[model samples]
Structure formats: C-alpha cells, structure tokens
Target: MKRVEGRVALVTGAAQGIGLAVAQRLKEEGAIVVMSDLNAAALQEAARRLDADAIVQDVASEQGWIDTMRSIREAHGALHILVNNAGIEGDPSAPKDPQGAPLTDWNKIFTVNSAGVFLACKHAITLMSESGGGSIVNVSSIASLVPTPFLTAYGAAKASVQHLTQSVALHCATSGYRIRCNSVHPGQARTPMLEALFERMARQAGASVEQFTAAFVAQIPMGSLQEPEDVANLVLFLASDEARYITGQAIACDGGYVLAH
Candidate 1:
C-alpha cells in the first residue's frame, strides 16, 4: 500500500506554490487531500486537477477556522493530517525593521503567519484527538532561525509558529493523544510570495529579478533556490506513518542554507 493510504489530509494555501506542491505530494501518497485557500478560483482549478476536495478558507479568522473544521468533520468524518501552510510575508513597501515597521503591518503579519497557525493547531488538535490522532505540519521559515533584519515582521511571526508547534506537540504527547505537531522551515524557496518580494527589491535596486535572485542564491550553501517540491517532500515524510516517532520538532529543508548562513 502507498504511504498514508486512505488517510484524509487538509492542506491550507493550496492555490499555488508550496501549498499546492504539498497537496499534490499527499495525494500521490494515497491520501484523500482536501485543499483550502482564500483564492477560490485558483484553489478550484488545482483541486479539479487533483480530483480532490477544496474549501475556501481564511486562516487568520476564528470563525473561518470553525467553519472549516465543521465542514471537514461533516464531509470526511475525520482529519488525519493538517498542514498549516497559509501565511503572508507582509508588505514589502512597508518598513521591515522593528524600529520602523508600522504596528498595523506587524499586526497584519502576525495575524496570518503566526496566529493563523495557532488557531489551526487549536482546532485541529481537538478534532484529531477525537478522531483518534493525526499529524500537523506547520510551514515556518528559515528567517525565524536566523536574524532577518530585512523582514522583521515575517521572521518574528514565523518564529512564533515554530514555538507554537512545540507547545502543541508537548501538550498532545503528555495528554496521551496520538497527535503529532511539527514545523517545517523552508529557506529561499522560489514561490509566488518570494518572487513578489524579489521583484519589489529588484525594482528598488534598479536591477532585474534574475540578478537579485542570483545574488540571494549565492548566500545559500547549496547555491540554488529551494524548490517547492523539495519542501513538500519533507512535509510528506512528516505527515506519514514513517515519522510516527517524531513530534514537536522544527525540521529545515533549506538546501543547507541555514547551516552556511
């Protein structure tokens, strides 16, 4: 049998990028994937391609989470995997440093990047426990593990996600729940979000995106941008039975970017 055969998985931010890749990977491993995203059009297209279920969701809202969980329970009866991949990088035009970043921007970033994960974990844990256990894979960022002086809000928010994952893992483990929670830190992946950032920075520097991308890749030890599939592969492992013994860990799939930096 395929890994995770017959399991039900919910992958957020499934419209594109890493989220889409993860959903695809899970389906390939024999999972019944339910994808969710704020972009209904893109999500529906992706879902139709995979022939998987899709839901419109805004991870930052409490009501959204409740409705989503209710829908999942009603449709699937149980959720075996919850991948919290929805997040934002904050406004590139806004001051990214702590001293200059607007409070509104900071709050906005936290609401989606960190608080969203927290809310997802909170709801997923209760349902997973009732369903006899499950796995949660939170998408963090390598910026959280290092000093992200240029993107303070994004880095800090992802750091909170990492910390929250650990807390949820320990709580479930000690409570005798079979649930597992872990965070995946990706470094310099070529995603829509990252590409947008690069474009903005490139314009500011009067240079092409390729020039900016190459300069950025030079900083990574692997000398290449991490592909969404690379991170999705690691997420697939974490969401599978093979990682039953692993929980509350922050695993980096950064192409050695974290080590060299």
Candidate 2:
C-alpha cells in the first residue's frame, strides 16, 4: 500500500509556492489532500490540477479555524495531516530593527504567521485527536534559526511558530494522542513569496533581483536556490510513518544555509 493511503491532509496557502508544492506532494503520496487559501479562484484551480479538495480559509481568525475544522470533519470524516503553510512575509519596507518594527507591522506578522499556526494547531489537534491522532507540519523559515536582520518581524514570527510546534507536541503526547507536531524551515527557495521579498530588497539595494539572488545563493553552502519540491519532500517524510518517532522538532531544509552560515 502507498504510504499515507486514505489519509486526509489539509494544507493552507495552497494557491502557490511552497504551499502548492506541499499539497501536490501529499496527494502523490496517496493522501486525500484538501487545499485551502484566501484566493478562492486560484486555490480552486490549483486544487483541480492536483486532484485535491479546496476550501477558503484565513488562518488568523478563530471563526475561520472553526469553520475549516467543521468542513474537514463533516466532509472527510477525519483529519490525518495538517500542514500549516499559510503565512505572509509582512512588508519589505518595514524597518529592520527588531524593536523598530512598528507595532502595526509586528502585529500583522504575528497575526498571520504565528497566530495562524497556533489557531490551526488548536483546531487540527482536536480533529486529529478524534481521528486517533495525526501529524502536523508547520512551514517555518530558516530565519527563525538564524539572524534575519533585514526582516525582523518575519524572523520573530517564525521563531514563535517553532516554539508553538514544540508546545503542541507536548500537549498531544501527554494527552495520549498519536499526534506529532513539527516545523519545516526552508531557506532561499525560489518561491513567489521569496521572489517578491527579494525583489523589494533588491529595489532598496539598487540591485537587480538577479544580483540579489546570486548574492543570496552564494551564502548557501549548496550554492543554489532550493526548488519548492525539496521542501515539500521533507514535509512528506515528516508526515509519513518513517518519522513516527520525531516530534517537537524544527527541521531545516535550507540547502545547508543554517549550518554554513
């Protein structure tokens, strides 16, 4: 039998980039994938291509979480995997100083990136518990592990996700649920979000996006931008039985950026 056969997984931010790739990977591994995002049309198109289900969601809201969980429970009858992939990089124009980030900007980052994951975990854990336990893979960033002086808000928000994953793992295990919570930190992937972020940074630096990308890649020991599939493959492993023993960990699929840097 295929690994994850008959399993039901819900991946947020499934309209594009890493979220899209993760949804495709899970479906390929025999999971009944449900892709959700704020973009109804784009998400529906993506889901059609992947042969997965689609739901509209905004992870930062409690009502959004409640509605999504109810939809999954009623439609699929069980939830096995939850990939908390929805998030934003905030504004590239924001101040770099961790403290200098305006409260508004900081709140925006936390609301979507950190609190979104927390809310997803809160709801997903309940469904997973009823389904006899499951796996949750949170998409974080390598910046959480390293200094992200240029994007302090994004960095701190992801760091919070790392800690939240750990906390959820403890709750699930201690409660005798067969659940695992882990974070996957990707570094310098050629995704739309990263492209947009770098484009903004490049503009500020008065350099071409090409130049910025080259400079960024040069810092990675792997000497290249990781494809979205590489990160999705890692999520696949973490969601599978092979990683049954792993939980409460933040794994980096950064092409060695975390270690070499």
Q: Model 2: what TM-score?
A: 0.97
Model 2: per-residue lDDT, tens digit, 57-76? Answer: 98899999999999989999
Each model's number of backbone clashes?
0, 0
Instruction: In model 2, state the lDDT of residue 124.
Output: 84
lDDT of candidate 1 at residue 232, scale 0 to 100? 94
What lDDT score goes with residue 240 in model 2?
Answer: 95
CA deviation > 4 Å runs, candidate 1: none
Instruction: Give all TM-scores, in the order shown.
Output: 0.98, 0.97
